[model samples]
Target: MGTNRWKKYKIEMLPIKEPTEIEELSLENLVDQILNAKKLDPNADTTALEREIDQMVYQLYELTPEEIKIIEG
Candidate 1:
């Protein structure tokens, strides 16, 4: 039998969010989703998720072009 290294932690499959649903997520919810994604698969590619988070932040802050340029840099 394999060692139960994660015995104390409960593991369950997270629901996959559709693109439209993801687009409507609040910033706090989006952050939670990102954290859960990382918890589920640290090595998995999260570029798309990160991109969505960036988009949400940009919208929330309503940053100007100069601010965005500075932040992007």
Candidate 2:
């Protein structure tokens, strides 16, 4: 079973402009934004960002949710 260890991980909210800036951008710009996301907010919501990245990957590879679950697990 999962423990409370996950709760110890720090999380922070992102500035609205940063997410808006990253949306609908070119691939190159997207990469740049990802690298600079934390720079925009050191305590940003990284878990959400990570999930966003997973969603991106799933879309890029055209993988189903089940496939992603297997891969993640």
Candidate 3:
């Protein structure tokens, strides 16, 4: 029998840890936290999250740039 080029592999993944506490937070608050935290961590995806929030707010409230800036700031 010829040696197999591809070997069978078993991959073990680590279990994910859940947050210690679940707090009731609004989406806006969550996004704001993400944005602020991203300033410290380069890997955080705050920009994409912010864009999603922007789209959501536009659909729901039709917020202007000034209004959005005021909220975000």
TM-score of 2: 0.44
Q: Which ten residues in a row have the lowest lDDT in candidate 2?
A: 11-20
Please provide, for model 2 over 23-52, each residue's C-alpha lDDT reduced to its tens digit, 9 standing for 90 to 100: 446445555666688789877665765667
lDDT of 3 by residue, 1-73 (tens): 8985553442234333332233224455777788688788968767766776566655456568888788778
Candidate with maximal lDDT = 1
lDDT of each: 0.69, 0.62, 0.61
Most TM-score-accurate candidate: 1
| TM-score result, candidate 3 | 0.33
lDDT of 1 by residue, 1-73 (tens): 7875554334435433444455565655767877888899988677887887787767656778788889989
lDDT of 2 at 4: 55
Q: Higher-TM-score candidate among 2 and 3?
A: 2
What RMSD does each model have against the real structure? 13.3, 13.6, 18.3
Where in model 1 is the C-alpha error above 4 Å?
1-25
Return the TM-score for each candidate structure: 0.49, 0.44, 0.33
